[model samples]
Target: MTASLSYAHGTSATPLLGETIGDNLRRTVEAHGDREALVVRSQGYRATWRELWQATTDVARGLIASGVKRGDRVGVWSPNRHEWVVLQYAAARAGAILVNINPAYRTTELDYALRKCGVGVLFLARGFRQANYVAMLAEVRPNLPDLRLALTFEDDWAALLDAGRGVDEAVLAERERSLQFDDPVNIQYTSGTTGFPKGATLSHHNILNNGYFTGEALGYGPDDRVCIPVPFYHCFGMVLGNLACTTHGATMVIPGEAFDPIAVLETVQAERCTSLYGVPTMFIAELDHPRFAEFDVSSLRTGIMAGSPCPVEIMRRVISQMHMREVTIVYGMTETSPGSTQSARTDSIERRVSTVGRVEPHVEVKVVDPATGAVVPRGTSGELCTRGYSVMLGYWDDEAATKAAIDAAGWMHTGDLATMDAESYVNIVGRIKDTIIRGGENISPREVEEFLHTHPAVSEAQVIGVPSEKYGEEVMAWIRVRAGATVTPEELTSFCAGKIATYKIPRHWKLVDEFPMTVTGKVQKYRMRELSTAELGLGKAAQIKMA
Candidate 1:
């Protein structure tokens, strides 16, 4: 397992780092002054370069008036709205660390993030889907002693806007001041799988550089109109959607609420959107929508799918039905500013469908043997490692954990198991920690999950290893059947028998109505393990069962 290096097909001398996202946005606004900058169609809100700058400044001034200072943490808990983008730029201009809070977070989750970040101010929506954000904040206010202001999108916005009056001139002057590119710009908490969330400290250079490289990889330009259905709280939206659009002076069309397949199609058609970015689930929903064929989606030129493995069928439909010219699959964790490798647009269809594409420009990726810490050769599966300008500064207030994930040589060890092909395309096999060993044979849970997804009755599936007496572990699966469909353990076992090895087939199955998921929509397999062990009453034996 010796590590080797392979450079990207094209290389350039351009620096991969930048001063600040705000600086880059200001330059774009100056160059494309009258151009449309952002469109929040649901709210009937649109901002050109000039109007966006003014609004950003107003928010910055309001922040200052509310006692925010450089390096202070400002938390935003809202859906994908125009104000969310305004808050991002305003915090950058004010030198405050923007902390994105998932709108779906419960009271306990919100309290934990707010206290962990020591957030001084919070911006929230009044209510969405029965979660009254303002009420939740009020409930947690007593516990969060550092919080000084609670501004709402519905109630307190006007007052906050009025507060921006006297400080307008000062805000403009402050925006002109030089900012350190390496300074921490935001803290994005990882979607915790095993334990509590950990904040990944991303610097201005980390995020801005990632945006630049992503935009260049997609060949984005001033006239490009990108549709963003992903939530703004995630790194995919912040870097790939917002920062990339700003860097290229591209128009960003945002849908402010939960994703609806019909709405997404309409937005693309009406806006003439050239690009779209979403998770695999989003694409699946769009493709499965009954009226999918009714819309004219020929305007869609390119798209980026990530967060989970996408089905090959979905990719095919994107090209054939939606007339997509390029569909790239991106892979990375929050610690890498969420952009490590992407499938190139020019790659062959087989390569694009089989892998997660090549490493982006100025980024280094390596596959290392998990047990020995040695780099694995090409075409071998190992833990993926990445090093680049986009690597996070560290976990906020968690030195030991940060040191464990990021090495002294600057490579961030992603806990994903993957193999690099001869052409440098990385194919994700499974998570290093999620791999199941059954009867002395290794099984990839992702492989089983993908196979299960192809089943007509299955809507979603999760596999985990549980304890066994004869074998070290046995395969166990929990599946969510599609509406009006029925599936049994024996039938699924029969289906997998010839398609995969007998040992990889699940010996036990649980048909679940819904899966416990994290805020970001990731299935919580660790929780499933606990539930299965408790219900089976097999004690330690149940813990070793593999799925």
Candidate 2:
């Protein structure tokens, strides 16, 4: 018989959960009511499961009184905060779809996202780093007709809770009872390296089950304390960090508002955290800290290193030095409720260090030819696709795009290049698409290209990801300037400073007459990356392996 096609399945004796986010929270609270549920050192706040449940219900009732209705889009634009966590469960409890807006977003990106989703109420932090959320929202809120209210965390959190006291508790209970497992509860804006971002509409069943399964892979329990330094805006924080801990009755420890190596080290030691979460760069930063030896991280036994692949060298050090012998790696996108595969704690060291591990429970994975759509044999590279309850309902309000991404058969095409061994171990080889993952943040080239085109000095612009040792990949732009338009790279930088995200701005710039193209005139981004890598003396950086 011919070798079987590349396909795999994840079996589970436990069935998928059929409960809403609120339902799951109530169940966990009933079981671990006295357990520590949340900790935010920046806010100097901590809460038990019962306290968290009370806070979430209060916020949910407040949202209802503030004119938020079921199916409404509620946006939260802030860094990792205790309010952000409360809003997450509260919005779900009130039957509102929570929209996670990136904290790094500027006026243009912010306005586009809020308007695109028709967000009714926005909760925001005033400022972080150089970006001013208060001013940016002020500049854009008038244009956002759907945005009836914008509440600042510094001034409004307490008032929102007080407003809930006026509403009847029965009303909040009714709203929670109306929510179902399949109801769309969260809209995560995913830029997948193309154009403006798309809101990946995920249901309660999609993320809750994913979080539960991920925690199970780590062998979590109520005693496990998870240190999460990743930002809450992404699935890495909300799903894998918070949701994962909540599902298993574990404590969620926030290192700080933003990721600081010292804060992570300090939090782990002080909190006696058993688990930690971050991208590979974060692990590198923590390990390479000048005072690394001073902190005792012996409490850590398990965690996850995701966003990008983890190098073997880094994995070795993490297991030995960080005392994370059960460290795991997860593989998925925002559309798959953010996790379709994860490494198990029992995986062999070689497999744990090298692969993305096996398919997730209640999920299926297959590698197939990009053109033929036929399953490829084992050890053959092909596009990776997943199918299961974890897939999103679809991209919010983008039916055509959704159809293109998820096939009629329900397989979510990942557009990622991968290979499977006979043992069904999945190894991510590369991407079929172009995306610049700078220090774990996914940057879209088209979004930056469109913004640069608005510049009068620029006739055309193209962006590519160049190899970087620091960020794994940094953005590079090649521009065809309009004739007689004398614009320097510094001028372009200044123009983009307050308009777009700082990381999305091109780190390398080149003035080009024209781009290399194929016979059909498709601009070849690979050629641009190659030429830019050679010209910028980045060969040494390119040679440094991250996986």
- In terms of TM-score, the best-performing candidate is 1
For model 1, the stretches where C-alpha displacement exceeds 4 angstroms are 1-11, 168-171, 454-460, 480-488, 511-514, 535-547
Candidate closest to the true structure, highest lDDT: 2
Candidate 2 ranges with C-alpha deviation above 4 Å: 1-3, 434-547
lDDT of 2 by residue, 162-259 (tens): 99888899998898888789999999988543478899999999999999999999999999999999888888899998889989999999988898
Q: What is candidate 1's lDDT per residue for 78-105, written digit by digit as tens?
A: 8888999999998998889999898788
TM-scores for all candidates: the values are 0.93, 0.82
lDDT of 2 at 2: 39
